[model samples]
Target: MNRSVVKRVVIGKPLKTRELGDQKINKLKALAILSSDALSSVAYGTEQILIVLAGIGFLAYWYSIPIAVGILVLLTALILSYRQIIYAYPKGGGAYIVSKKNLGENAGLIAGGSLLVDYILTVAVSISAGTDAITSAFPGLHGYNVPIACLLVLFITILNLRGITESASVLAYPVYLFVLALIILLGKGLWDVLNGQVPESLHTPIGTAVPGISLFLLLKAFSSGCSALTGVEAISNAVPSFKEPSAKNAVRTLTMMGIILAVLFSGITFLAFWYGISPKAEETVVSQIASTVFGRNFFYYFIQVTTALILVLAANTGFAAFPLLAVNLATDKYMPRIFTIRGDRLGYSNGIVTLGAASILLIILFEGHTEMLIPLYAVGVFIPFTLSQSGMIRKWAKEKPSGWQLKLSVNLVGALITFTVLIILFTTKFPQVWPVFVFLPIIVIIFHKINAHYNDVANQLRIEGAYRREKLKGNIVILPVAGITKVVENSLAYAETVGDTVIAVYVAFDRESEKKMEEKWNAYRPDIRLVTLHSQYRSLIRPLRRFIDVIEEKGEEHRNSVTVIVPQFITKKSWHNILHNQSSLLLKAHLLYRRNVIVTTVPYHLKK
Candidate 1:
């Protein structure tokens, strides 16, 4: 099949530029697509807390309630701060744009690089967690988690490549399903407890109670649970993806997402405490809660299935936000310009593909183990949270818009809280997260290099004055050939039209072949001059390159320009072309950097 046909079938036909407006989604779909990450984090967030608390003893596990409350308060602060961001910078670069405009370019790059890394981890961690949910329900799939997580990444990447509206339509249901399933589980679990119908498993002894946990350990647990706040900034980053009145729509969606996330996170944590659930290697806290509340019946499976779907689909948030962030960086010349280009389906295909590939690499490296990837998660997330909030504080202070002091106070609280979380995460997660510290600076350096290169190229290409043309004294066309054939004849015919002088040069392995070529060329009645060069080591490119240098040196004497016409045979199939020697391509690449030399190809198509 033709490539275009394959692309059309895979991602649907290309949309007109005008259809970009049509691609904007309503708040409902935006909530599902953008909030999936924040919402799905509830699956693992409580477990992280429980695991930390469980480390000391089951008694410490109850500390999760206060920690959960702390996270909720922080989430509320972030929600309000990002809401202001959405309205203030409606074009929607989120942390990157806000940091750049208010804090400085370096701050922006750090914020951008941190978010980029976080988005990649979001996909990896979410998909791996999702796969964990799967294995929790069906133990048979445990060993296959890596492949499963990778396939989920690929599937979501394709969905986003199909376009925002289309992806939303497909992914929205599972998010809502997950929310509904969790609600049901919470409701039924609460009712059972209130009615004194608790499961027998709840009475089982966990361990001897330990009285104390260090402040550092408690902070570690708090930092781990902070994963719940991972995707809270995504709505602000993607305000433009909403329908008209995009900022308002994005703010509303952010509010809805905050409410849902708070309720689900708090409910799950509560049920885990009430049901005496702890994180098990084979099962998640959510899975334990569901099995306890609904038993291993239909409702139990429904909760597990929906949880798995939402966790996997939660990667959709990264898919939606990373590309838009990349476009912002590209617009500012910090990233490659290709990132600014939209795909046939009105999505940033390059960024989506890049994110998917990176996520797959991470999933494979961690072997789809969510716990291993989790330690690397919170640091990248909170760095941007702190920076974005800090940037917002600066913006409000400088501009002092209407109600600026209140906005400043809100963002100040957000910044201080997130920065405190960042310090805790760094101190606690140093062993696993140190690599992020190393990688963050490297990424920022790369951004600087790319921006510098673009700046240099723009300076070189910018035209400052009226056009001035240089007159060439002469034009010389040199045609390199392997043998005399129709391709050579056709190429020579065109070379004759281009310049008065056309030299057909051939590289021969032996004297006999050189004599035969010269005799054959004379017999063919070709008017062009044929220069025969012998290669002692049978190196074709070296000898040809030397001859081109000789010709270029002579041309310089006459102020002449040199053009090398390479004759290439076009095979009927692309695969067949690969079977033949690509010396012409190598030659063109070799001469591409010469200032006065031009290279061109004359292709003769094969019927076979």
Candidate 2:
């Protein structure tokens, strides 16, 4: 089997165009596929907030309560706003789509560029955080963590290449298992909290302050907790990926995801407060709380295992959305044409591999350190969040259909809150996140270049008025032959059908060879004129190029074009191809760029 066959076997068979509709997912799988990023963020969201609040003494827990509450409030508003977006554009109106429709092309492009960058960062940060969880559980394996993260990326990449349904099937169990473990942990812990079995240290206020619990610090802590809301919009962006009644299924899934995320976020925040768990360099806050609730037993390890599974698999969200978003960008001519091509499994195969490769680079560059990478994650996501919600407000104002006031109020609140978060994330993390700024301009410029190229191509190929099918105007076939072998005879025979006139050209290096060729032509009488040229420089390409250029100079006179037929000798054994000279291959390469020259390769296969 060849490379393509092997690829199909590895990635799954090529799905037909109509088979795409069959690939739409049910709600269970859609939740697992699209909600992984948001759900998994629960594993680290509280930890991010605690990192900032650690400075304010044991009051870190005190500060965390309000931040978690704020995040929940924002989560509700964003979900309500996005539900409107899902219904408004049931065919998946992501930020780029919404902004482009309501705002303008530049706004749309900016949103697209931001979302693209965010998708890449999502994979990298999720994998890195997941790997950190593993090392926190077993400190001895810490040195090899980056390589482990890269391998995990490759694993998820293959799963995604198998198509969304297959990936959802593989991932659904772990995501559901994680939710089960989390709720159980939360239920038991909450039951203990209410029953007064909680540790006394939680309420005992140790007034040790790490100095600055200022307003800036509180805002930063709130912004940090907002990371949990990162992947919430993915559901609204990918509404069409659901089964029939797609909008209803999608909105339901989005609501379910928000509820689950809110429950987990608040549960963990409450647990962290009761348990007085602070961020540890070696262990995560979730791991710490799990130990407090379950204590180094089978259930504790179960929580840890499932957390790692969901976190690493969180890249699945990027896998699902990136390809879909890439196809959208390609359709709009903002990305390369290749992104619009489907793979064997009918997933956005190219986009899958692209996200994987980019994440791997990030994992290596940052050494798989989760804390270092987390700061860069929020800005890209929030830009789209702000723009998309603001666009919805604009759209509602202009359209003002039924219930526009309610919709406008929800989106306005979401827009203001997200814009504030975006600014806070930028001002606080700009030192570490300068890369995001640098990367955005490059991405936006690339979008412009792609749009420009597509426009130029469209203008060149546009057929206005009526397309006149002109007859083949004045054609000539030129056969470049080495000797009078079977290959030459066959090439000459095929060249006869090329046009009205055929010329068999030969390059003679010496007088003896020229005389021998003329004598053979005379004896055989192939009934074709032979134009022989002398070669001073043993380079075969130079002579063929000169001949084609000479023909090109005969514009509109001796026929319009020259078609060069190059015969390729295919060996029975692939290894034997190196045994023959590649003169005709080189000849075709020389003639290919000439203005009215056409090059055709005719394979002449040898039978043993």
Candidate 3:
């Protein structure tokens, strides 16, 4: 099969422009797709809290509920805050766009850098944690886990390249499955408590003390639990991906996501409290909770499997939003122009590939350790969250449309709250979060450089002076040909059209070859001078360049400028170009940088 045909098979047929409406998913599918990262965070969000609390022994476990409540309060305010964002910038005003427009370039770049790091870490940490879920169950295959995580990333990337809607379909079932399992566990545990059939595990003394709970410890636990908020911005960022009346659909998804995150996160924390589940070295808190609830039976395995599957698939959220963010950045010239090019599936193919490559590097660098990857997660997310919330405040105050005061107040609260959390996270996590600050400045500098390059290019390319019709510049066009073939004939034809004075130059390695070339040229008599030169060293570009210099040395009245019309022979297959030496490309590149010389390639595509 042809390569394109294979691609079509893998990604499905390309959708037409009008058919984009068909990709707008329903609310249930939207919830599963968009909310996966935030919802799946329950698997590790509670674990992260427990990890912090476990430092002071079992007594610290009680704080998990309170810390979770704090996180929940933030989640609710953030949900409402971002709902305003979705409506105001329904065209999908992610932090970068929102902040840049309202908060200025620096703030926007800050948000962009933060979101970029966060999305990449989302893929890395999500997959690593997902792999941990499996390894926690099996334990034997833990040694080969980094590679396993990378394979999972690759699988998701391929599915995303197929198109967002298709990726959502593939992701929906597993995500919903994970949700169902958790509900079953939470519901069953709650039922048992109400019916007065509480298990023995619930009496396992969660109040055991070492250092006990302290203010600093509670702050750390709260910050760890903020991982649940990592993907919250994704819905706002991807608002344009929603259906007709996009803002309405987006608000619906955002509300449902917020509610689901609250219920799952709250239930798990409560259940952990009820079951006396604490973090362990060998297994996770969720795993421990599952074992206690259902005694490690099939339902337990089902929960573990669904948990692993959803955690790995949580990367799908990054896969969806990162590319859309790239497209928006590219349109604003903060990124490369190539990022704007959509794939056959109406997706940003360049952005997807770049995201996948960046993710693979993160997975390898972190070596798939969830502990190493976790502390680095919150910083990236909160920066964007704060900046976006702050930007929303500006959006409301300036736009000040209907209900703008209330909207402004909500965003103000969200901004202050998220920013406070950010400050706490930075202070408590100064060591772990330092890399984010370092990497952020580096990325912001890159964005500046890209913007500078684009501006400089636009300045250079823009038509400055008044458009006056003048005779085209006087010129000598040189056609460099190897032999009297169709390619040469084509080049000469184009050269004649370009310049009044056209010359065909050929570099022959030996005198015999030079004589045969001159004889053949004379026999064809193409109404132009055929200049042939022999070389002892057989360096074609060097001799051809020297010949052009000799022509310029004349300083004749007609020799005002010179153009090198190089003939480019194109093979049918891209790989076929590798079979033959790229002499034409070499010659063109050779002439390209020379002062006062212009190069043009006349393509003669082969019919092979």
Candidate 4:
């Protein structure tokens, strides 16, 4: 009985007009995309401050307000600086392009590497934050954080796989509702405070003393709260994803995001201070403010639902930006080529899978604890922040500015401010954060070195001018054959085409089988000469090597142009077929290493 394997070929269809067409996202949708990260910050950014403050006690809740305000100032400066990025380089490379064009490839690689790590952390942090919020609503979910987190990651992956516009459209309304609910809650809290009806905090019974406010503590808190601004840079990377007048739309989106973040952050901080919202005593400042203003009734539940929805949607920011940034990095040859190829749906499939898996792992490692992840978070974000801003400074320095001298000065100040913030972040948080920061740069540097090595090896192996100019006038053709099959016939035919002095060579494992094969070859092709080499190891490679050495010693000039033909059978089923046991492919690979030895394969296809 004979078995035949069939290979299936797939044909690809072009994207339909709607799929390939640009997304006509209005101001709201664009705002939703840009603010997806910032709006979601309300869910955990305050919690992160509280977590840090909790270490000191409930009295430190007052510090959250000033910290939030500090974050707002930095966010405003960042937004203005990025507006320049949108105007100057509208392409999606964002920090990578800015760094590469100004500082050089090493700076670009550093920025790209930092941003890549930040995107992965964004996914992990968002998912962990969402998991905590969900567990708060359902206490039974305490131990199931990892499973639920992975499920959330899987769900987000599916949404992204559907396409970017589709995912944004799905999340738009819920994100909007989250913003409205937050505003309403903050407004009501302020109204109560204005009327001298400030409600007592539910968690005040925890009765904790605030830590003494030092410059270092304040800077640490400010850097932690700056987690709110982590995703603002995504807009610069996603400029091309916008519709017509891409740069204008990106700048508009950036402005809207900045305004929204500032208002929500400032209002929340005010309400937190006015009502004494404390995570040291209470888990979430938003929930505490919600319960205080709206009571523990339907409004509180509504706020909880919307808050959770927004946190989940915050992960959408990473979903949208990671793939785009990865594509840019891949294009620059700093990353694997797979990231550069888009899926059938025009999404970065590799980036999506990679981002989701990494985020889920981080969530599990942190036990879905946003606090534990926060220290690690700011390190990645600020590395890119300082590098990209430095790139912008270099860019302005190089350009001959005419009308925008003030703008250039603003960029310089912006770079200085961000650089200072980065220094503070590294110094204050590095004890807890440095381990993560150290590993990422090490991995990136290792990958860069590996790629460089691969390119160097490939360059050496490539045929050069001198090698190609040499003629193979007197080389002998050695055709290795086995049995009286089509593989042997094909090898013989090809060898004849190369030159007239062609000999069929074979290795005999034993004398009996050797005699049978030699008789068969003579019957099949009497015109062809046959030579057999005896092998003690039962391996073809050793015998072939010995045979070639013998031929070379006879005449060096003849050896310089020799061609080796090996008849190889092409099996339809890749797994089941074994032609030379363990040595066939290895033999061909070894032969390829030698100079002046040309190896040719004669494939024999089996009919069904």
Candidate 5:
């Protein structure tokens, strides 16, 4: 099938430009679509903390609740700070915009690069964690986790390419289901704890601590639990995707997402502690808790299914934010301009596909193990958190708007706290996360190079003073033909109209073909000059390029502009293209860079 037909089938028919406004969603649907990442982290975020603390002993797992509380405090700070961002910069560039305007270009690039890396990792990590849930429930499917994660990435990529509203509608139900499922699980678990019916911890007992809970271990656990805050900034980054009064609607959505996430994360961590759940090789803490509360029945299975779905859909948050972030960089010339172009469905299709591909690569590289991937996760995100909060402080200081002191204080505390967290996360996650620091600078350097190249092109292309025109003394058109055929005849006919001098040049590997071509050209009598060149090496491109070079050198004296028309036959079937030599294509590629030479392709379609 053709591209248009396939696209229509995949993403549905293309919507008109005017229909873009109709695609805007309300705060209700926005909560699910944009907040899935932060909300779903409750699945693994609590587990991550327990994983770290469990290293010391079973008693160290008690630290999970306190660390979760700390993460919630940070979440509250971030929500308030980003709400200010939504109102202040409604166009939604997120940290990149805030840093660029308030900090500097270099800081902005740093923030953008950090966020880009984090967003890509979000897809890989979320999908991997989701697949973990799957394997936890069905041990028979344990070995296929990487493949499962990759397929989930591809599915979400296609859904987002369908456009924002379409993806929101399809993904929103699962988020609600996940929330409802967890609420039911949490209620039952809490009731058991309160009524003195709490069962003993099901986890295998770890012996007494080798080294008791040190401040280092607590910081490590806290940093891991901070994954719960990954998607908090997504709503602020996507303010434009909401309905009228976009910023207000976006802030409302942010508030709702924050409250729901706080409740779910804290509840999950508390239940896991009470049940003495620990990360297992084959099961997640959430899965263990759910199985304990709901048993091996429908409710238990329901929670697992929704948990997997939400974790996979958490990549949707990255999908929503990464494209917009990329567009901001592209607009600033730090990225390729193609990322700025919206696809037929009005989504940043290039950015979406790029994220999906990167995520798949990461999943394959890490073998879809969430524990291995988690260490590399929080640093990229925290870098942005620190920079964005710092940038907001500067904004408040400079503008000094009404209630600027309160805004500045809010941002100031956020900056100091996030900066401290960033340091702790880095120190705790060193060596495993050292690669992120190395790559962060490389990404920033690449952005600088891209921007510099675009600026140089703009300078060269700028028509500053006046338009310059020079009258051409002569016009010469070179038509490369392989043999005497209808395709060549049609090309020669058009070539005659474009220039006063048209030369039909043929490259012949042997004398027989040359002699035959001369006779046929003489008989056809198209009234254009015929030049036949022999190549003993059987190289079509080399012979044709030499001929064009000679023509350009000779034409220089007469101020003549030269054009090369390559005649290529288009077969009915695309597969038939492989049967042909594609010599015309090669000739065009070779001649396109010659000064004062124009290359064109004239295609003659085949009927059968």
Candidate 6:
């Protein structure tokens, strides 16, 4: 049976199944899903500040509060802008949809590339940050950061594969508990500060300032704090994850997430400042604040546990966003088409696995160090931020009514602000974060180019009525045989089936092998016509290619009808395939250049 024919029969019509049930996610549930990644960032979002400030000495902790405030301002602006997105394009293309519809393919590609890189980094940073917290609890795991991070990535990937509703349901409690724990801790810290009974630092000399306070240090601290806003854009990508009235529900969810994040960020930053948190004096600002409030009591343990749990869940955001983005890109032909296909569970399995592998690699490369990866991180996030806002502005400009000038003016202002921030982010961070910023876009551009090339080739090969008119006037088939093997037998059989004049061509790379092969051919069959081409160059495809050209130039009648039947051995096990060669594939490609000739493969499968 022909494989293509069998495929057609097996896939006769699309099967209808209720795999994705009509479960409508309300605003709260949608918020849970969208905020899973961003909320989780509270676990180690300030890890960069602690690490960087520590390097600059303990006094830098004071600046962390102000920087966190700046980041909060940016986050608030982004949330407001994205509210418009949830209202406008609720189908969940996120930044990609916004840019593509309004700014063109290049802008869309830039947005897509940036978002993709950011998501991958989010996974790596989150998992590693979680590992850091875990290691703090159990110093025994200190040396296994990469292994633990990779395992966590795989674990998150599995949870995501269980389906969106399932993941959201399972994560809701932990995320809620995390929020509650932070609120309690922050409240306790403030009460202590107001009472003037602030817990003393473990190290009395910790508050001393370092010597330098350069612009570079400030930018570094800003970038570090910027990580808290990492997952704010997730809501934009998760528009479809909501139930009916997707846009309205998405906007509601977005609003909820914005409020929650704002409140949490403000509380956390305030507590850290009130307690005189120092990155140099502690590994994490949260940990430092925890120690100050709880004084190594049960409350401290509770904070550690919840913080770790939340950071681990931060990777969940990547787990969710990766698949949706993959589906969108695959639909646009930017990725393998298989990524676009949902599994029985209504999950993008291929996309999940791809994301998992990428995250693991990043985790290993940065050794799960979120601080080191933070500078490299925001470049991807803000590129999409700027372009998507610009896209939204363009949309409003073109679609808004004359009477709606006020609303359009707000969008224009948002776009300008976002664009300016994007410039500052890139200019400020790209030099230090050059590796990720420079490399990620290049990778996406390469993918775009490759996809474009495939599209162009596919267009050229698309058959029409005129294609048959250009077919060879006379029938000729070239069958390349190696030995008295099943592959050779299958090739001869298929050649006979073509109902045309056929030639069995063989190339002799060496005198000894050629002599042995010729003798064997004669001994096996004396009646068949065998044409041997000898090459001292030890090249197989080139000699066979030249022979076909010789046959073509003999006459137009000969050139008009040539069909090459190349026998390829197919093995079920990929490793077994390595034992064979790829000369047949090369020959088939070379034959395609000849005018009026068709190339077909006769595959001989090995028996198990």
Best by lDDT: 1
lDDT of 3: 0.81
Backbone clashes, each candidate? 0, 0, 0, 0, 0, 2
Give the runs in model 6 whose Cα sits over 4 Å from its true position.
1-16, 46-65, 199-217, 402-406, 427-431, 461-608
What lDDT score goes with residue 36 in model 4? 82
lDDT-based ranking, best first?
A: 1, 5, 2, 3, 4, 6
How far is 533's C-alpha from truth in model 2 (Å)? 44
lDDT at position 540, candidate 2: 64
Task: Give candidate 4's TM-score.
Answer: 0.71
TM-score of 3: 0.77
Instruction: Give the runs in model 5 whose Cα sits over 4 Å from its true position.
Output: 199-211, 468-608
User: Which ten-residue region of model 2 has the weakest summed lDDT?
Assistant: 464-473
Error of 3 at 246 (Å): 0.9
Tell me the tens digit of each residue's lDDT in model 4 across 322-416: 88888887665566666755554566777888898888877777677756666666766777777777887777777856656666776777778
| TM-scores of all candidate predictions against the true structure | 0.77, 0.78, 0.77, 0.71, 0.77, 0.70
Please give the RMSD of candidate 1 to the true structure. 14.1
Q: In model 5, what is the error at residue 579, expressed in angstroms?
A: 32
C-alpha lDDT values of all predictions = 0.85, 0.81, 0.81, 0.72, 0.83, 0.72
- lDDT winner between 3 and 6, please give it: 3
- Per-residue C-alpha lDDT of model 1 across residues 44-83, encoded as one tens digit per residue: 8999898888788766767888899999999999999998
Better of 3 and 4 by lDDT: 3
- Which residue pairs clash within candidate 3? none
lDDT (Cα) of model 1: 0.85
